[model samples]
Target chain A: MTAKLSPRTEIRLAGEGGQGMILAGIILAEAAAIYDGKNAVQTQSYGPEARGGASKAEVVIASGEIDHPEVLNADVVVALSQEAFKKFASSVKPGGLLIVDEEKVDSTSAPQAIRIPVTKMAFETTGTVALGVLVGLTGVVSREAIEKAVTARAPRGTEEMNHKALDAGFTAAEKARK
Target chain B: MAVKLMQGNEAIALGAVAAGCRFYAGYPITPSTEVAEVLSRELPKVGGKFIQMEDEIASMAAIIGASVGGLKSMTATSGPGFSLMQENIGYAAMTEIPCVVVDVQRLGPSTGQPTAASQGDVMQARWGTHGDHPIIALSPISVRQSFDLTIKAFDLSEKFRTPVILLTDEIIGHMREPVELPDFKTIRSEEYRVTAPGQEYIPFRNESGDVPPLANFGVGYRYHITGLYHDQVGFPTQRLDEIDPWLERVNTKLDKHLDEIALVEEDYQDGAKVALLSYGCSARTARHALKLARAQGKKVDMLTLFTIWPFPERQVEALGERVDRIIVPEMNLGQLAYEVERMAGRKKVRRVVRANGEMVTPQMVLEAMEG
Candidate 1:
């Protein structure tokens, strides 16, 4: 059964503790597991400090059961902070996708990288940066699956703002692609 | 069936409710705290009861009392809290009460790393309470299995009229995964009923079966219940005739059902030379490592145990005979390895362990396999 899911896609989301990356990882996993009907496992590791500490969430999406939940060599790395980018830049698999926040990360080590002004767009629109990066990840995955996950997981009264942020993210990723 | 993406802890709570567990009493602890939280919210909606006890000791006692009053009951805790519940847990075992105790183990001797995962309590779950007794402990490696095994735990506890432990860890307790759970309406638990009025009801009658029928306390069945060695009438007994039979019945009930109690998953390839044995979260590590090894063209077989306690001696011995070397990886420092060594002999069993907060990675197990 696992043979069909050979070369599983691993996504690593790295940022500070309070940036909602854990929730973002869960949304990504839900998109794969519930919306896409693929087997997915999401795990997170954070320091004792609640904020301003290195934190990471990893999701392994496959067509079969996920044996190890931890991400080893990531197929996609989303770095929302300079610290996160410097630490996890090398952990990405060769020729894998590296998405970075343009203003946040200065490292240019990744040969093939996509820069999205996620924080600036969020601040200029929703006044929060977490959902923007999460939505932009959809450009790398299934847009419909991620949008559905955001609708299902986002708290009430914030759905409209989140949807708008998601649209902005899609636009930003599209512009980066061009 | 509706498929929902849920954390292992939430699935466990839902599993308990589906198993007809109506009462839960627990004090919060890390990793395992979510089980209590979910149950506290869901149990009420299902016409069940949930209480936050002062501590783990009271929590264990409360569940025992609820079970005696004719409700399926459970409690969840971590290593330190589990230690505090030992005395009352033995009380449930001695009284033959039906209940489930969930121990989501963390790294520990005393207040050890709370958020980290570990299989350190394997020995403690089996021998935590003193005296000769029989116990059933089931460990699940994935979130889906966590739900299924919780139901199984309740079923086994009710069937054998004993306390069963749902042994899990922080990794599975916190990891979120998609699962299509079993339909609740189709699930059935072993039944307990009152002896019809006017007929003599012996709570500990040891004649027909090892497990005497347990009647709910308030269901017109007036019987004494105690923690001491008890006679057929439930009164404390010291006589050899009464004590010997009571002791024998408790110990052999699980032994007789060893086939039902010992559940394992084996993946063997033809002409495989090495065997990797693991349980709980470490089993995931073993499976990942096995896949890596197989991908590299290494010949290895894997045995994953869902049943941890009353150790799967027969299965381990067979694996030991089939392969020249056996590797045991656990979150603790060789807790389950000790039992594997005892069964497969110390020389054949190799131990790979990590006690830190982090998980045992595939690389660690792969390196041990290569060595």
Candidate 2:
């Protein structure tokens, strides 16, 4: 019998410095902790420069204690930059999922990679760059959970645009779903 | 009430929040920046404010200013920034402002490494500010203790109307562990008696404690606060007799609370001939090392210090008499080891120091403990 997926999910948001990778993790953690009423832990590391630095944020959503916060061999690695993929793909354990932005990330080696064109969709829907791309990617991997998170978390005036951007991401991820 | 896994850095920020700190200002520095980062995001949500100032000096100053405006305030920094704020920290001491300072220490006499651990700031935390002052500094090894002691830092800072220092190393700051956060109301900040209405309010007058009741600026009361020596009315004092009382008042509070402030964790206390005296992250390794020594039929007792300042002179002296030889395994050349040697009142002590940034393991401390 095929066992069911546990409610516990560990996700990573990665990109270049200006990619808003940390915002994705922050929203995911807020959603889980504030809405779903589950435990969450968010950890990140970024290099010195704010522009070209490689940045990654790990969000672990578990029912119990999240020991070893470094995200030892993440079950899901989201790569938003080519540099980020090169750095994080090796750290993802085998059989775990890989979510990649097809437009920015060149994922020739990711075994179970899902290619979602978050960049193109982001530009088309929101007319902005980073926030749209972040919302799109966040909504895709998080499914409908990102909507509640964004509505609860986004600044008051930016809600309508963020909601639209999240929809764009969800549609893109659903189309690319294998 | 959720017992979630948290890093020590974030826990310190959470401790600040639970302790009713509504104002935070700091620049981003390694190991300590995470505290500011966490506070920056969460503070706005809780109706508090967080500011990333131009630099550490301005960051430290902004917090001091905000405290005078009637807000429980704090800032966090590592070694290099800590050196920059020494002059302002002295200002807080002289003015007797109530605030907490968190130093997640890193390796440095200067800008050495952004991610390496070191306890080289023991003496710096004690006497970093110029002139004479008695400061309360706490060292936390784990994430849970970091949260707990941060609350204590604010409590002591407010109770004594002085700046309290939370001295943590990079190892503890970066290390993540499970911690159960207590209720905000449960996290207590001492309530010192305020002055009665209409009557004169002496900002530096106290009947119960050595520290006076701090009166915030523009709180319908007028009082002078300066970096120079001051008397009961808060005016700067230059008289020789007043200077003696002024220095005595500052030193006596910490000295009086020395016994109560002393925190030690003793294990395997069977009159062990060899005593391992250590603190901070180095002591975490000693716990395992002492067990190995005990398994080998070696009599070893561990004295882990949670309170680093005021030396815990009496408790340390008592332990000094009980042990034949004291081994202080630290991360610096010889900071806390010097204190142990002084309290022991003899050269019957050895030091196992490491500055390599990769903690001194049990094997290293064991080798020193054997001799």
**Candidate 2: tens digits of C-alpha lDDT, residues B199-278:** 56777663333777777676578777788887777787888777777777777777667666788787756758888888
Instruction: Assess every candidate by TM-score.
Output: 0.93, 0.70
In the order shown, the candidates' Cα RMSDs to the true structure are: 3.3, 7.6
Report the backbone clash tally of model 2: 0
Local accuracy of candidate 1 as per-residue lDDT tens digits, B62-122: 9999998889999999999999999988999999998999999988988887877788899
lDDT against the true structure, each candidate: 0.84, 0.76
Top-TM-score structure, candidate number: 1
Instruction: State which docking tier applies to candidate 1.
Output: medium
Which candidate leads in DockQ?
Answer: 1
* Alpha-carbon runs more than 4 Å astray in model 1: A1-6, A48-52, A102-117, A123-140, B193-196, B207-209
The segments of candidate 2 whose C-alpha lies over 4 angstroms from its true place after superposition are A1-178, B193-196, B206-209
Candidates, DockQ: 0.63, 0.06
Docking class of 2: incorrect
